[model samples]
Target: MNHTPVEGFSKLSKQEKIDWLLQEYLENNQDFKKVLEQYYNEDADLQKLHDEFSENTISNFYMPYGIAPNFLIDGKLLALPMAVEESSVVAAASKSAKFWLNKGGFKTTIINTEKLGHTHFILNVEPHKVLHFFNFKLKKKLLEATEAITKNMRNRGGGILNIKLIDKTADLENYFQLKASFGTADSMGANFINSCLEQFGKTLKEEVSKEESFTEEEKNSLQIVMNILSNFTPNCIVRAEVSCKIEDLKDDSGISNEDFAWKFKQAVTIAEIEPYRATTHNKGVMNGVDAVVIATGNDFRATEACAHAYAAKSGKYKSLTHCTTDNEIFRFWIDLPISVGVVGGLTNLHPLVKFSLSLLGKPSAQELMSILAVSGLAQNFAALRSLITTGIQKGHMKMHLLNILNQLGATEDEKKYFVNYFKDKTVSHHEVIDEFNKMRNL
Candidate 1:
């Protein structure tokens, strides 16, 4: 079937939009409309709010919201809210949290809280002249131009920290950058930073145009390329760590405490040195981190981007987590660079997000960063523990048992039976299906 693209799709109402989608893409299937409408919010106001979150909204895509209790971070016990669909993530985090609870839990330190952005422009002026203006006159003008924008932030002990002029003519013809650092306080300051960068861009053109030091040709050559906030916040860092006596690391994994400690350390070392291992290792860490991030209405994409970049900061992709076993002590930790906000974006609008923040004790931005780092650390520990012990498939497949049962169309009684049956036996897709077929035949 040939489908023509429809114009003015955004101008249509919600039902009209769905009708167009069904006719063009879904062949006007009534069942598709039912499926879309089934997930719509019953409250008209809430549904409208959801629709306005993005364009051409037909329905809501939902993920399971779960809580992992028993997290002890910085001497405070709290339950973490996680939003995800994958199996075993929440369970693994909770298990790790409980394991380390009595062993002094997770300790975190805020290393830095600086975010940055850049204003890119091009000017055909001499490098020395550009530097002189930036140092003496342009910097002040840029700061002065942003005073109104930074006022409330400064009142709250956060604002523009410093501005630097970086020459990039070697990379491109007459290219330059105004690198600005910021402190955002309790919010992820994307809008604030971008606003300031745009002002800087305007100030750059204006100041360079009026400068008597520059010729008319040089002044006209000035072009403001773009102004944007960078998601790669390396200085916005938090460190989460857990440590205990190696002798106390004994578990039912049939391995000695000393052996387990050394093996764990070796696994982390392999990830640190090998790129292949590090990719999967860090993915497990993000499984925990992203869950909490989504639950709290923060930007997971930015968090993920910053983390992977930080991992490869040494010119090679390595593990974000580190482990050490020395002097009869075992330590595991991660220095995560992530930016999150508790008082902005969807925090005030989304009902569940509000509940999630309150559930976390209404933490500040710094506290949220620590929680995110700890979640990543706990997830890494859980994955490594399973990997070094009974193997990952054992626990992961057990958690996956119900999904398999549902796929096989097992009844409630059959599901109950398989739950007990797989308790001791190994679970494989073919074996479960074969056994299920046999039970049905019998």
Candidate 2:
């Protein structure tokens, strides 16, 4: 195959990119072009708005937006919106919500809400001199220098919480950091934290330029490598928990309540001790967390990164959720570092995001943290129950049946018949296709 690069590929118009790609890749381009055009928003203004969310306006890709209801959190019933492509995620969340509804639901609390950022610079001078400079007066000066930038955040009861000097010489020679923490109130504070760090970096340069505490060599040594927000927000944490009597676990799987509780706890223990199991185990938790985060227009990518970092915070990768049974009482809980925003990003722009936030009673950032934590815990609980009892594939395949039928182009009547037919029998792509063929032939 001969390959040649297209000049100015990025600068090309969206349609031009589409046309070029189609021409180079496909024999019949019009059919695929029609497929792309079919998904374009019918409203011109609405389509333009979606296009500005990213560069190179392609057809709007979509995931099913679903509502998992019956989530009773802190004595309030919540209908959570989840935007995910997986067939079983929403169903599993709904099932877990209902299961916990009668068990006093989920109790959640925001432990803290402090976002962090850092200014990395190389200090050719003694580490002690930099530490002393930060400790003596530079810390206050840094905060003061950023007052203009943080004025609005301060007025809203949030601003710089603390500043510290970090010695990272062990990692890289002459490397040091000015670590700062902030309270961003209802916003995720990425921009806020970065703005503050940039200001601090500039101030540090100016302050060292005139400080009599350093020689000419030390004065010229302070060079800022970067100043940016850290996604590993350990201080931004939330805890969500659910508890019930062991005898209260009712299921059709024919397992006794005691056995179910024991097995569930054992499953979690396995995740805690085994790194291989823990990765997928926490991934199931994020399936619920990311869904709700996306629906609410929060930064799920940052949240996922922070959560996985927390999972390994103990020097070994482990489960994000914990399950236990003591004295015939069952308890499931998770304490995770999740940084999310309720007032910025797409919250104001996306119509569906506004509706999703309003549906949750317009929770503040802290309250949203609790809700997100509960979501992950509930998802983990549901998955463990399925894994131990009826096995995960049974329910998962049932949820996947429709997608398979659609792929095979089964008619409405055939779909309805196969849905009921598979209620007792195991479902698979081949089995569904065979049944559909037999029914259509008849």
Candidate 3:
């Protein structure tokens, strides 16, 4: 039976593929469009507000995009995106995910550290005498602030787990951090964390202000150098694993299971010691992970920054995932921060964007991340598959050649011939011209 294709989506036309994507984007992000119109359009006064809050704006605001599908994270299936544009990203992740498809899929857990951070001012008053002050009518500001934080989270059934006030008296440069924890269902908790932070900051200034010395300038300077939320996500976490059987991998290629296992093992090991290789190494992981980020409307920039930062936290770049081949099977695993959320911000506001979020039965950040981690492995597998057999460009360059030809207005037959001719060889503009003339004459 021929199933009807989705509206505005044809399996054929490249433009249709892109159109389908755009349609999905619009359907899910209705609320976001208004926000964008108000805040991000070319002439919005939001920039003025940003300047008032901090001198710098958030960097890399433009999201990179790609999709990872056929994923089951924490036993639930999903289709997600990686908001990055780098090569080998989505491919490697999807490849890796597919490789482990037969394994019990991916299992994940979310640890919701429902904590919000608040800034404490260090006035540089008396070199050694530093104080933590509250802005409240009765000087019960801390309690009020804590109660608000707790109440906000509790309303969501997360309920604040704990609250702590920290003072760094030893270092003048080190001020104070107010840590509060809350719950995020199945995600790493970035959404609630960000909202709570914003709420807490506003609450401190307005709900309680006993002493007026706690000025906006000081608080603004303390919380951010850029008018942006910190990438340090305080929400959910994801832990995932993939298992594959050796028999499933063996096909007509006469490629022994042992050979495939040995090659993949060597590749991962070599990646660990070589930064040159490891950059692509982790990119493989992000290929899967980032796709989930974009599909869900979470901050891909933050996730990317955290992953790269974590990679270099040891002072040298390295892989964030582990892979191994056991008796008659292969297994891969990843544990990374997927603190994205389901019910807030751009995800909820943007109509088209909301559709994207809902595609997965309303997944949490870790559930999303786990699906991505597997996809990342799949993407890695695709790259490796190409490397082992036909070389990476054979399939890629062939498809690219036709894409270029189409851009030049190649007709259906022309596109077909151009693709075939370009296969087993690379063509030049002159060759393209010759093909065009020949096709026109034919």
On a 0 to 100 scale, what is the lDDT of residue 187 in model 1?
Answer: 98
Model 3 residue 42 CA deviation (Å) reads 21
Which residue pairs show collisions in model 2? none
What's model 2's lDDT at 86? 92
Q: Write the per-residue lDDT of candidate 2 for residues 322-420, one digit (tens) a residue.
A: 988988899999998998899988899888899999999999999899889988998898899999998888899999999998888878987898889
In terms of lDDT, the poorest run of 10 residues in model 3 is: 122-131
Error of 2 at 178 (Å): 0.7
Per-residue error for 371 in candidate 2, Å, reads 1.3
Alpha carbon lDDT of each predicted model? 0.94, 0.91, 0.56
Identify the leading candidate in terms of TM-score.
1
- TM-scores, all candidates, are 0.98, 0.97, 0.65
Q: What stretches of model 2 exceed 4 Å from their correct place?
A: 1-3, 437-442
Superposed Cα RMSD, model 3: 12.2
Who is ahead in lDDT, 1 or 3? Answer: 1
User: Model 1 over residues 1-442: C-alpha lDDT tens digits?
Assistant: 8889888988999899998888888888999899999999999999999888789888999999999999999999999999998889999999999999999999999999999999999999889899999999999999999999999999999999999999999999999999999999999999999999999988888898899999999999999999999999999999999999999997787899988998899999999999999999999999999999999999999999999999999999999999888788899999999999998899999999999999999999999999999999999999999999889998888888999999988899999999899999878888899999899894
lDDT of 3 by residue, 344-382 (tens): 656665544567766766655545555555555556656
